[model samples]
Target: METRSRVLFVRAGLPEPALNVEIHDPDGGWLATSDLVWREGRVVGEYQGAHHFGDYGRGDDDIARRRLIEGSGWLFVDFTKGDYYARPRRLALLRRLAGHLDCALDPAGLAAIEDSLELPGPPVRPCGA
Candidate 1:
């Protein structure tokens, strides 16, 4: 899970670190708990594991939840295991998102941020990307 989050941050080039966040419905009902939430950008990052679709009932519920969230003016980026493991595809998605959101981070800035992390090659994706 940490690896996935880190990859997302690196790919998205977000300015802030990804934090565990949850969004509630307008009525204060539980909507979804996102792996990362970029509150300023109104985006949600979801790391979907295979268990997310392990059952028919769960899958149906997920679909309904997603619809409700989307209707509420939030963009969700759902990443599966494949997306986390596949660098090119994941990076492409991140770039597309950066373009869509008009994010300020450039590749160099992102690289510097990743380097400062003191971890490894990649960086973590910001929340809400």
Candidate 2:
């Protein structure tokens, strides 16, 4: 969730999606606790940490959760550490996913965000410099 918050900040003013959100099944049972839910857009974002693929049961649960979420007309974007570590790749993936849902991020707005994050430039120099 800390990482998600940082990413959201880097992306600028997009609303923080609801975290650890619960969704119910037709029979009223708990379907899943989505990491981040974009309620109005029916989009969900999941941050897949190390534990996600570590065991069979965990993997199976993820599959089942995805199936249920998809069944409800929501799109999910699954992210791993590698994705978060690379800004350009992450942005590209986000753009593609947003495009798929016809809710693309505004390019100008994104550029402003990048500028605010100082992302396009090289990393900050040492104090001596």
RMSD to the native, candidate 1? 5.5
The 10-residue segment with the lowest total lDDT in model 1: 114-123
Model 2 CA lDDT for position 51? 93
Highest lDDT against the true fold, candidate: 2
Model 1: per-residue Cα lDDT over 14-128, one tens digit each: 5453567778777787787767666777777677788897999988988887887777777877777665456565555566556545685467645543433233453343455
lDDT of each: 0.63, 0.65
- Work out the TM-score per prediction: 0.70, 0.69
Give the local distance difference test score of model 2.
Answer: 0.65
Estimate, for each residue in 12-76, the C-alpha lDDT of model 2 and write its tens digit: 33544666888766577777888777777777778888999899999999999999988877787
